[model samples]
Target: MANPGGGTVCNGKLHNHKKQSNGLQSRNCTKNGIVKEAQQNGKTHFYDKLIVESFEEAPLHVMVFTYMGYGIGTLFGYLRDFLRNWGIEKCNAAVERKEQRDFVPLYQDFENFYTRNLYMRIRDNWNRPICSAPGPLFDVMERVSDDYNWTFRFTGRVIKDVINMGSYNFLGLAAKYDESMRTIKDVLEVYGTGVSSTRHEMGTLDKHKELEDLVAKFLNVEAAMVFGMGFATNSMNIPALVGKGCLILSDELNHTSLVLGARLSGATIRIFKHNNTQSLEKLLRDAVIYGQPRTRRAWKKILILVEGVYSMEGSIVHLPQIIALKKKYKAYLYMDEAHSIGAVGPTGRGVTEFFGLDPHEVDVLMGTFTKSFGAAGGYIAGRKVREGPLVSV
Candidate 1:
């Protein structure tokens, strides 16, 4: 049934109801037969609060919204699924038509094997929904299935109120603590979720400047630049800082973002053993002595990149020793404190504070707000300013 305003009424409930121009309202009936609406607006008022409240009341199932528009998005989604199924069917048909001895090995074989044997197995056992916000303790839906199938169902049974040992909520700031939630609520009411523009454009809010200043004060740095994403903070800015004719000494076990940024910098890259100052020193000395490859000319700059904490190994960087080597070699140091910023040190000032070294000793201090601050995005801090291309979202 269609309403007078072009909204659809399904199962005695109104759906796709639009109160404002160019907006969508998707309603779902809760388990208790209460109809709740989820709204999607272009710039503001995304999702109604009642939809979230409905989820809190009945956590077993979720309603998927069917959005209508130009149909391009829906078409693409169906096209992707169709192509994927077609490829699988074609592969299976080819295997059946040919003998095992006559089969030609392809890269798809490895991908298929890994997808079926490894990824599916791990995903089936581990992937589940966390009922509560991230903190030291929360609720998670425990996977009840042991099989590796494409479609799997979760049991209504929830491992309620379990100690959260998996997430990176370092300072236990998540779980909507009273003070944080109050501040967040006020901000949301004023800002309406996001600025909807890039920092270089009209998106630069007073809060952005204030947060940057606060981060600089906390890290004891001269200036800081905040990015929209933690991963982009490293991946995008590294290319701006160093380019061709520079030498990059990176830790072997550095994060992939750092690796990508270093590669994009178009500099000579060398990897040292993880957290090994001796190996770093050796690489630094060799680079300083040999200079750039083929050209044999002195490098414009030498950048030593390491992380505050190795996320995979859970080992903190040897900052003091690394700083000493950087000073000796006249190399600039870039420290990624994504994991250590709010988790390490006496007061959570990161690895520099934990090692009793001055933050100024490190040339560039980079960290993410996702961990301890219970927020998104990242920041880059430095003593001097270097102009680079600004990324617009």
Candidate 2:
């Protein structure tokens, strides 16, 4: 079938027509034809003049159209109910097909199982694409199709301008800020790209030293070491700080990186209820009294790990209470401020400044530049600057 825009809908595929430069001609091609043509031509161009019309009915598109029909005084509640039932039936059929070799067993293939069982439920369900620059408000393409699977043919159709509600521009210093962009551009022009190697292996730029000094001055710490990755900062450093005979008391709701780091450290790890000083104290007391399992000897070292702000919970950590407990238990404190560092406090100095506490109170301070700083990588701040790889006793 042909739409008003000279586009064709054939066998659950979109056939787009383009006016070739040779003449006033409309060449209709299916999805596969378009892909093959692009491969032959080495590049493909999108014609703004050619308007596409009808598309296949994907589940999300169907629901959207059904809802719109209801809003416009049509009885679509029954249709919505029917679609839900259909989806449930499809799910049930997939689950019951034990002999189907195409579908991997849940135990054998975890990712594929999740894709089939969970992801498919809402796959191609929504199209909130940003067509223009990522600002406070931008253009979103609203399109629906039956054959529009997430893993298959998904296209941007029916563009509409809307305000962005979901974004990681925590401090409003992203693309919207001109000064930051200009500064970044200037730096990019001068520096080209990355340093290309780890700092130990001749990757240390003068800019690196300046940044570390600035971070230390800002955090009111003696020294700071920056890493290329925020996640790796925690993952790699935790193991260096504590090991075998040492004990690690971690917040139950700590970030995945911290959990992984603690696990790799080979430390006797005990979890405390998130943000609960009482629970933390109990765990500390028990660890101090019991020590290692079977041996009951004193731990070589005790490390208390927590976050300045819980990213998932949106709750601030009880730093004062935790600090008191750490002091009482004689445990080193490691605070991850990935979300809090540049997003909290009047001057954006992080949780330490927010809580009116000294930065030195926390043994190790960790944060990332991906959020408020609008940069990449992470940093680890501490009392003294150490050369080579960090080694904690």
Candidate 3:
């Protein structure tokens, strides 16, 4: 449904304006939401009159100013690009050597322009250097930029007692003093870093099998496979599950890793509105009615990709509704619990536990230990028949 001010009226709630990852602000509502606090002059402020159960639209003027700010930044970027091209301003972009003039440029000029004139001005807020454990409170290393944020150097100063809100340390297990820290030290001494090979070869350790068993037991699934990294877990596995004749109904706001995986799968990818069961069901219905594109035949398989918790929006998935729809449509459900596992639910088992649904209802459950366990790696759990193929990926 449409909103009064050119936004989507999501679930009857008018969400506060939030800066998207691309630096553009969006006004989409968050599910199972929380009121966001606004800071003013280094002081935190709250809207005491607003009801917590209902979200209010950001002030019209605030939205206006937000766009205006971006517009101004874009205009300046264009002007800077013009100046640099005209040789009025010094060019900081990478120069092509005379011998390699025929070679394609490594980075696009427009990308460098946006980076220099737009992102660089606000880059300090991201990729900050921290000198302490990413617990509730940590230490940040202060640095200074002299060349208009083009390059930065250490100021030899540390900002102490900083509250951590950026990291995915949802369980506070990343603390240096946690009991797991001692266990990690002991394991590190014995393991000596990594296995230095792929799991398909000599890299498979008894501890790896033990961890996979623990993960399967944790999710109450038949079996599980662990991967070295969270991003690769999704990006590399989806292609193994489905291809050419398959259709993937993915949530619009799914992580980049999921997006990459779907693209790599050689499947027909269709996007459904984020966290909306109605939108998802509509897509599933259309897929069934229309069948595969061009061929006018039934798809080999249909995979539905969703996240347990949308990391950027802090929105929880409607797991029960989605499960019902997937079953009705006879589609496969692949739920990524990267940010939800060991962080939400009665026992922190994830959305399935939170909604009191059987884990098997979700065909493939993917999650990362990086967030909730404060550990590295990710896992995919399901029936042994379903997960068996992913080993080849």
The candidate maximizing TM-score is 3
Q: TM-scores for all candidates? A: 0.68, 0.67, 0.82
Candidates 1 and 2 compared: the better one by TM-score is 1
lDDT of each: 0.71, 0.71, 0.79
Worst 10 residues of 2 by lDDT: 32-41
Per-candidate alpha-carbon RMSD to the true structure: 25.1, 26.0, 12.7
Candidate 1 ranges beyond 4 A from true positions: 1-116, 142-147, 154-157, 384-393
Error of 1 at 42 (Å): 59
Clashing pairs in model 3, backbone N/Cα/C closer than 3 A: none
Candidate 3 lands at a TM-score of: 0.82
Query: Tens-digit lDDT track for model 3 on 77-172?
Result: 899888987999997767788999889988776666667788888888887899988988989999998878778999899999998778888888
| lDDT of model number 2 | 0.71
In candidate 3, stretches whose alpha carbon ends up further than 4 angstroms from where it belongs are 1-56, 95-98, 104-108, 111-113, 386-393
Instruction: Supply candidate 3's per-residue lDDT for 44.
Output: 21
